[model samples]
Target: MATVTTDPFVGRLVDGRYEVVSKIARGGMATVYLALDRRLDREVALKVMHPHLAEGSDGAEFVSRFRREARAAAGLTHAGVVAVYDQGIDGETSYLTMEYVPGTTLRHVLQDERALAVGRTLELLEEILDALAAAHRKGLVHRDVKPENVLIDSSGHVKVADFGLARAVTEAASTATSTILGTVAYLGPELITSGRCDARTDVYAVGVMAYEMLTGRLPYTGETPLQVAFQHVNSDVPPPSDVEPWLPAELDVLVCALAARTPDDRPVDAGAALTLVRQTRAALDPAVLDRRSVPASSGTAGAVGTAGTDRKSPDSGATAVLASVAAVGAATAGASRAAVDRQAGSPAPAQPDSTPTTVLTGIGPASTAHLVTTSAQGDGVQHTLAMSRGDLAVDGPDDGTPSPRSRRRRAGWWWFVVVLFLAGAAVGASWWFLSGPGAYTAVPGNLVGATQAEAETTLRAVDLRSTVKEAYDDSFPAGTVISTDPPAGGKVRKDGAVNLLVSLGVKMLDVPTGLVGTTADSATAALEAAGFEVGDPVEDYSDNMPAGDVLAVSVPEGSSQPHSTVVQLTVSQGPAPVTVPQVVGLEKEAALKALTDLGLDPSSTDDYSETVAAGLVISQTPENGSEGHRGDKVALVVSLGPPLVEIPNTYGRNVTEAEKMLKDAGFVVEVRHPQGISPLNIVYAQSPEGGAGKTAPKGSTVVVNVF
Candidate 1:
């Protein structure tokens, strides 16, 4: 059974126009409700920030940031981007309404399909990048990019959601101490180190997602989030072929370049990334693009056709570039190569040599002799790039001869440098304690929206202590910091305490009872008076309840709702009345049944009609279109045929005589020549044959046969 999560905003009108029907979902910053735009009579997804966040001291700032981001996201008009309609505040609740997409998220899809085929992954990524490119073109970056934010609609079309809301892509001015809004698994190296983010950050995240989609597992996993984060900063995201060696070299190059340790190696932005990906896709062979993807954990390596691969595959580091990416993975990588191509202006790349050498270069220090060998390909294109760590590499020939005396000379120089370092360290320590980092350090700001642990870590780094206070918040997740005591960017003495308001989760309310006996207006007023929001009244036909009176009421399962809680009331319209239908000119039985079916009492009276046939209704009381209750009396005058009359004998008589006789008998004369037209104009037979007991209605036609 689904846990009933109560929502206070349900059945409540926001801004006097949007009616909250029910809660749809809750995220880190807001609770989404399926709401009705009363003015437009359409449904929209309404995102409402929890009271703690929206009503905090920084509420104005949060709202301003939210509005700004929403506007930027709204500026993006694309089929793949979720549309933002409006943003506003009602009382203390900050809300943004957007298009309501009905579908499962890409995260859910990944949960079912451990790994998607190459063609399918490429297809999804193309659409995702297409949308991201649009935002990047507008100078907007979706700081958070992951499968969870990708929505697959009912028709299988993709929609990217939570763009600017996650956090706008900003310059790398801040550091990791600020509230990092994206999933840790997909955070870029720049994002992990500095609070700053740009289009490249999104590109990095997309690269991680692509790796996960193709490998069925994250590139890095650790016991703690911090461990994984450490690897993201310090280690290279190995080629996907490391796990599944059958994967093509282009894929390895693509993933490595996007997930490069530094931002500069990756595509400049999502647009650049998209351009690179499109080119790679076009260059990829069909067999490789549509190849079935098996999880790397499956331990199955097979010989199959792949981009620039031999019939039999070689493991990663042999045929493809290792974890290091240098020349490719950028929009300019191709153009730079074209500039050096033997055949200029050609769409296809030039054949360099028979072997492509993928080199691995270490950043910073500690290059402990790592060598990667490459294989020769039939394509005869040798791609070579080499970078050396001059300082870390040993400077000696392979011969076992005694080296020059430079080692001893270098050792003497190192000793002299150490003496100087000791003298400088003594001076540095004196300044470090006196008005330096140890003596006075600013409190780490940017704690709001960060997790409690993360805030504490940041404070610890800045020589400040943290104390957390708990409160209920519908928007912020449990254990999430809702606000900071001194606000972000405030200065404080070293080791000072920075208080935090942490969320205990959303609050639930008591369900309102005894709504069936009161009038709709009474219930609505009472609910509204009790700090609850009233939804539009629902009406239905009821036998016992009087019109405008309450019939039923619906409440959420738990009391997650607080002030502005939604209250739904069902009003009775009383018993439905049936319209009396016209029975005149209808068959007696049909007319009677029609009234009976409508719940009206049907009764008939016998009468002779001159125009209406026998057993047909002539007139009805309480005429057609008049409303009547069930079992209401309906009087119908049924015809008993016109007044019967005797017909004169026309046998062996002139046709004219028979016609005249029928006319005199108050019947219409219709002469027939079944026998044949008689020269004597004699009538051979007549309808009813002028029988003694036979009679017809007055003005009814009579037939006479002439011989």
Candidate 2:
């Protein structure tokens, strides 16, 4: 029977800004969706927390933690970390908008290939550790560190995601009996017992992941989640070389040190782990790094795109690369016996890396199991506990059948299990061939914003062709995609065509031209004719143009530009006004030179002055300090010698009359030799001898001799 699922938010608008396009993935904390940001005209991943996580004030703690995801991921802007764009609560829906990465989770890859090449595994894990290192340095710890939290883009670039469980190192501790919120497989023992967590906790989880990647299986597992937790609290992770003989000693040491049952035994944090990993990678022989553990031909799942609807070729530019790893479960009793043989001085004494336990955890204790969606393993999880030394036991009902350890000891029974698996696959193969890989696919979601060439490449990756049509779209840049026929997310045949409309940019219009020397009104008319808006006239000085005449246009003439672009006209305000400098008390030639330098016409006129000296400026017509244009005129006054005055013929006359005569002649007079005042007050001697031609300037001082 087919199961039908309906989503209320699938087509709903989120907070009036994000338009939910399709569901991407679901996890223990939230459901991820591919959404369109209407405001930014871009796509994003919108993660909406489950309603049960945050309902209202009662869920304040949960809500706060949910919101902290944004701050935590936002603070980490490294390329290996997914970016957060926005976060808010729209009614009861708390959501976060993040950079939409077109890729698959590492868990999915592990699902298809079972294990990966050692080089590829390290290449991917390095980025994950680097991102975690950045977060750890920022005082944050990613409580959940597993394959599901790692995203690999189509280009094989790795990005760490799901900071939903991230918290400040100070706030990482939680009650052991409470939620105990983390996947059991990666949880450190301290997190299970003491409810204490720090950067070291994340480092421990990373070590488990490394072991799984190298061996294609988790380190421990149980029928019940508690059994897994029990192992985490008691056991130590073994070296990967035990299962995959090709693994190197360095990797074995790294995995063991990272997954040590004692928290103090592991690296201090992801930073320490990353340094060790880099050193190990550098020192390892190239042949070992390049060695393939499991080939892709072993039940490889083709590339899966966003929402699991679209398919991509392995070599596609935007293809999804998954990393799927099975859970740690009980090893066959035969393998366990082999391990015991090594412990008896076969491989030397058990070092710190060797312990009776395997490094792995399941979900929290049964009390908190309802909150978890994943076990210690990823999707399609299986229990294959890879142990270094211990009993291969799992708890279940007390049936007549033997214990798991007893059954596993009979390695010959594996033939029956293999026959059963082959039979089931044979029956399912018919349905898959009819309706799965041989049928339809969801149109790629990345075509709406990609370049024409890129969109075509994506289409071809899915065994489809692209048909492009040009459009005059102003919203997107030229040569970029505008829209697609049938749109994204719609189902189509595997061999169908994807029609695309590419933008030709805005409609081209002739630029504002021929505005110089024209009137402002005419310039405006010309701009309107060119399909442009005329902005306010900009005034500037132009020696050749008159006021209100256009001097230039903002845009170049005759150039093609977008229609209705605002073009400003530069209008001439005749010529800039020149300020007349003060020329008062300056020499006549200097004053004339100053006026001429200012581009003003200088004129001179004669004048007699008592205070001003001759050949020097006295005052100007337009004042010494006034505003005038370059061609305006300024008048200067040239001084002539004071009018000549004849000396009075009163040498022998009365001194009073001589003084009066001197005064009337515009001269200052003074009496001499008149100490006691003579009876007639007559002049004793006249210095000029009553000369009529002797002259002196007006206001000149004259002396009269008196008896």
Candidate 3:
């Protein structure tokens, strides 16, 4: 009943069986702890409900719901769903034990990275969808599906957790409520308006998550929870492309459709939503399509093309179309120059036309022109050009016969070419500077076998430096140079450092000897002392070695192997033959103890034997002193001693006299043919064929085979 606070109950023993190790997570209703199940020798996540909440009027009802939900979650076997192991009450506390998953939540991932690449983001999303779809098929709805509820393992596997809030759709609570119970960011509109929820509701939340991942921001924001809830009820979800224009429009539309205001407007269910995602993903790129093998459609192609067009050139008026095209072309050219500079390990190049220019050119037929300029400083060649009459002409400083329009066009084009030339020159110079230096060379000498410090001093005389990197080699002596980076005769850079790989000497160890005929434990200890690990020790019944002694150590004595290699010891359990002990004529307990002393269990059978005393062993299986191994069953026959006798002449006696006589003889009486006229009540027939039986076991069924 205690509430978990900052001072959690970690390392506390509970019920003398479980020890809490650490708090794994806490929710509004319960705290989960990673605990050691000492009795089972395994780790478990124990979710303990708050004590105060457990005592409320609805407490019993909620407890029942929690158990039911936990059982339902446990029934699921998907790898993406966390496995529930056990649930019970420890004193007054209610806890459910589950598999412990070590990982961070998707919420933590989002908080740390803000955004992930599209491929990684989609992969995680699809895994979440797969888990949800499975849950939906089982008629369980996970009321909360958000970043915090999704866990990502170190290996990049995504698992859905915390199904405690899930409700079976057929449950009365789900059909009766309209108010929301989950986080506002992921709440579906129907959950707010009508208190109704289904699989589509979860699909809507997944869509919201996808939107956030693509744009690095939530689709909706409000001042308070109520305001956000209201938005879910009234607003239409915007396409992700509206925020990040680079996102594929088909994907944006699919995500928006999932976040639709009405549940009916969204996909049919989580399964359908997953299908749409796969189909849309497949149609976007051939690689995705081939891997997923979903068919492509014309509609998908057109949607992608439209998205590209919308992002190509922002200016749209017919009069400015030509100018816009030219501007886009220049922008693309500048982007290429920047890319080239980046690849060449240089700073980005300057834009061709930092400012736009308009000009008129040609003497016969003048035309308006837009000019863009670029600058390069690498290769040192510069040229300029002018445009007129739909033709771009090279311009010269000495051409004197120039119209005003031609002169204006020539001036702008010349400026554009000069800028590009300067940018190209700069890119070239950066490439040359980065790729100039090569590895350092060693000066001619006997330096190949010199120590690292000696080599450094000699290399410094040639304007080079030396860095020693160590390695193991058999051909080179320890602490001696194995090789140099540039070799001895190669050309050396004036300021480059030579990297040396030195020898650590050949690997060698003495072969272990004399391990046979010793105990496995002793052999293992000896091997470990010699830097070897112990492998699984094999046991066999040996003819030559005594019990619990080593027969031979694997990897044989005097045979060299790697250091720390596992050496397996084969131990002897001794010979297989042994003699069984005699237990007959002894008391049953004494007989059992005698067999047990020989490492055998006495298989017992009880019988009445006139010759043997009561409670004594009459006989044993395999006879006495038979040869057998340990664990062989030894059957024993214990005696009850003597049998029951029957009453004589009871048939002719009166009823009372007969009953008393039979009772005195330890015989039970039964009247036979009571309804027949039989010599005025004198008995005529008796069982045991009338005095043929010698003795019968007491309490044995004496069926006068009943007439």
Off by over 4 Å in 1: 1-8, 168-177, 296-707
| lDDT by residue (tens digit), candidate 1, 1-707 | 01123876688999998998888778666788888899999989888876665454555666677788989889988999999999888877778899988888888888888777777887888889889977876778788788878988898888998878777223211222255656789999887887777888888898888888777889999999889999999877766655655565566667776677777667666655665576567656666666655553555433224322222114322222232222232323322222222221112222224554333322324422222234455321222222233432335556744356646655664464456446545644664455233444444556767889988988888778888889988778888888665444333446778778998877655555566778998877767655677888788987577899988876742344665467788898887788888888999889988988887888888998777788888899999899877767899998898898987788888887778888998988887777666588888777766867778767778888887
TM-score of 1: 0.46
Query: Over the full model, what C-alpha lDDT does candidate 3 score relative to the true structure?
Result: 0.62
- Superposed by TM-score, candidate 3 places the C-alpha of residue 389 at a distance from the truth, in angstroms, of 34
Q: What is the lDDT of residue 560 in candidate 3?
A: 76
- Ranked by lDDT, the better of candidates 1 and 2 is 1
By lDDT, the candidates rank as 1, 2, 3
Q: Ten residues in a row with the worst lDDT in model 3?
A: 322-331
The global C-alpha lDDT for each of the candidates, from Candidate 1 onward, is: 0.69, 0.67, 0.62
List TM-scores for all candidates, in order.
Answer: 0.46, 0.44, 0.44
C-alpha RMSD in Å of predicted model 1 compared with the true structure: 24.4
Best by lDDT: 1
